[model samples]
Target: MSIAESVVRTIEDKGAGAFVESYDPAEENMVINLGPVHPSTHGVLRLVLELSGETVLDCRPVIGYLHTGIEKECEDQTWRGAVTAVTRMDYLAPFHNEQAFSLAVEKLLDLEVPPRGKYIRTLMSELGRLSSHLVWFGTSGLDMGAMSAMFYGFRERELFLDFYEMVTGLRMNHGYNIPGGVWQDLPEGWEEVCANIVSIMPGRIDDYESLLTENPIWLERTKGVGIMSIEDAVRFGATGPIGRAAGLDWDLRRDMPYEAYGELSFEVPVASEGDVYARYQVRMAEMRESIKLVGQVMEKMPEGDYKNMDPKIMPPPRSELNRSMEAVIHHFKLVTQGYTVPAGDAYAAVESPRGELGAYVVSDGGTAPYRCHVRDPSFINLQSLASMAKGGLVADLIAVIASVDPVMGGVDR
Candidate 1:
């Protein structure tokens, strides 16, 4: 269909909520900016809103406010070192970012990560998902005027951050997932700590649901508001919670297994409402699944090397360097010059909390990548904002933005 036909159809279909409403030409449509600074925009996102009274007529997302050119910077660093930059793209789900870049590089080298390493990656990735979703749950509640949900969400999220610090030594943007595997093995007594975390999550999720799921105010604000049809969601490239909420039953983890996902079992949470409430339901269900996956990883955790032992890609162990002069030289060269990848390009994607996070790497048989690009779900999911917000109340727009959950770091990267 033509652009005009689509716009008219959208208007006609929307009925009382139509975006293109007939208004007096003499009374000019009000133009307003929602934010590059507003809290609900979810970090440096500006929505140029054309409004008639309090209803949104047109919404245009103005991004690049937080752009740091990280993709270009990745090209300047060694392929192994690029994870540092990639992890910072989606600050909320940093491990997924790291995993995507690492997987792409591993594909280029035809390297297989050890079973233990894959399990560790899977464990960390799921923990990261929990962390990301917790923040979303809290912030979404805060947006709807339920202040306590914000505090509760952050409180639960801190536990996972502690777990991250215990394992990776950093809470956010930890470059733990390297090309061949993880940076190091789990710390002593990690299994006990992980078990405790998963065990308590079901009750905590119950707490979250009790607070907002059936609350009359939340239901009034969210149900039937900011609805997106499955077609519009796909056209807008919305994925993750948003896509699943719209009845798009596509998940990269289940459909395209990576790491230890193929060996693990978990259900993908899906909903058909495609509203703010449906988005909430999808994410909440996902957190429960993440907890289940974490428990499975602990039970099925394998025993083996945590990293690839290849001399070409990995630096010699510290024990080896003490006995052999060649090990010393190899370690020095690997640290300073990095390993060379065969001339080729590869793309690897992982299911992130927000959506599909992918990395594309090109090599010229050199240490550094010739080109590096990330397909961030936040960037693509942000496109659905206009469709969701169009014809909705200005207040409802805040809820819609919160539901979409576009992190500017990823969107502008």
Candidate 2:
């Protein structure tokens, strides 16, 4: 008889009770809820984990605990006003959300924002990217027990936001980018504040590397934990740093250019490790590239009308209303009824800090959107958590979630 047959015969003779008794029930599996309320989650994300002792057998991420119906809310607002709602989707990469939505509206309207507007959008997107990474870095460090990283990361973010406030008049969710272009031109002294931030960030990044990249505890916790194979990452639809870490080697900024990304030269960093450490390294490198792009945008930024000068789409300047009766009527109509887009649908995507942030907008020749749907990267990237966490120690699961860097606002929205 074959060895398999002999073993089967023995098991048949011994019976089901004997087989059941062969292994400890405690070692079989234990189901536990990790959170809808945990810090490492970065927002209200609950993960159901099946544990075989401390080893994760399987994980199911439970999302929507923080849902605010942002997509649905977008349809209620005017085309230009939708930015206020969509900007809240990612929470961290608000500019990217606005950019994608604005680009989609522009596509539906068949309008191009002026060169200076395009460059400004690009600059803000990069700055938002840096801000997003800093948050990720801070939280990842906190999750891993490197307390200093949080402080350092937020320090950079505060200075970054100071520049944001200078231009848009709000640090977060500025509602700055609109359908035709931004809400206004870059304010006076924006260059000086931006220039100082760009100058000091390079040395700070070096300091961050020294603290965590080579630290024994950080290396031990993150180096090989939560390994996702390149094939699995692709199958799971993982993108951005998570995808790049698995050797995807594709950045929408480089592969699929948007905004002024085509004009700005930068490197797309990729790693084959597909581990928590690889994700960390990928984000760190991306921050450097964003800093470089910010510098380029500032240097080459053109001077022109920030918003498209089309009176049908953009309201005439407040100053123009004082002089011209036609301008008065234009501003009143735009503020009240809003501009109607041509009846059509369009999808525009930008490389958000997390991954591919896409907006699909439907216009029915109305002041408001017929339908607006956001393909948030947080939602897409969350699918990989189970794959990354399975077969890893339970403790490292925190590191895995942090490495993915999901913003619950985006996922649940």
* Off by more than 4 A, model 2: 1-27
Query: lDDT per residue, candidate 1, 44-108, as tens digits?
Result: 99776777789888887767889999989998999788889889999999999999999999999
- Count steric clashes of candidate 2: 1
Residues forming the 10-long window of minimal summed lDDT in candidate 2:
15-24
**Candidate 2 C-alpha error for residue 295, in Å:** 0.8
Pairs clashing within candidate 2: 35-46
Quote the RMSD, in angstroms, for model 2: 7.2
Cα-based TM-score, every candidate: 0.94, 0.93
- lDDT of all the models against the reference? 0.89, 0.89
Cα RMSD, model 1: 5.4
The Cα error of candidate 1 at residue 323, in Å, is 0.6
